[model samples]
Target: MVTRRWWQKLYHRSGSSTAAAASTRTISPIMYEFEHLYQMAMEEIGYAIDSQTSSYYAYDLEDAQAAVQACIQLYNQLPITDKWNPWAEALQQLQTRLDALPLPIN
Candidate 1:
């Protein structure tokens, strides 16, 4: 079942008694979240994969992996509409790299 968010409820509320009005969600905020997640994972994982900084190892590798997982979850939860196709495609690279990481040490 598709659950509605509080913002969705608020957006749907209107005094004009036309039953329901169509709405278009602006692209900036949606892109912002995706970009933010990408930047965070990139900050932590980018150096590890980049040959130039591979030697600069850190213990937070697991954290970076987790961030990527969050991104993937967010992407899955997002509605797969025509307008969202581009953003979904942009995230595929991040998902692929995140998938190939070695399992975290115990």
Candidate 2:
């Protein structure tokens, strides 16, 4: 079995920590609420795709794909104005940790 990198473990650990913290602390209730709304929006998008595919509506499929892509692009564009933009910060930390590891030379 292959071993996972330290950064991978760190990423997972950080996510777990954030989830736990979010659950206990209600400082940003609106942000937490938005998370639930965002999840529901994603689920609706998935349902749209399924409906389009099952109905074999070419236009509907294309529209659904475009909507999903737009949503993803918008998500990627979210500004990380501070050092604690959780997702971006976590990803950057993971990359830094991964890069610090020495690779085995063949």
Compute the lDDT of residue 52 as modeled in candidate 1: 30
lDDT of 2: 0.41
Model 2 residue runs over 4 Å out of place are 1-27, 54-106
Top model number, TM-score: 1
Clashing pairs in 2: none
Q: After superposition, how far is residue 103 of candidate 1 from its true place, in Å?
A: 5.8
Write one digit per residue (lDDT tens) for candidate 1, span 19-86: 22212344444444555556666665664455333433334455556666766676666555623666
lDDT, model 1, position 62:
53
Residue-by-residue lDDT tens digits, candidate 2, 17-97: 567868786645444433433343344345444554354344333433343343344445544442246644544443343
In candidate 1, which residue ranges exceed 4 Å CA deviation?
1-31, 50-58, 100-106
Worst 10 residues of 2 by lDDT: 1-10
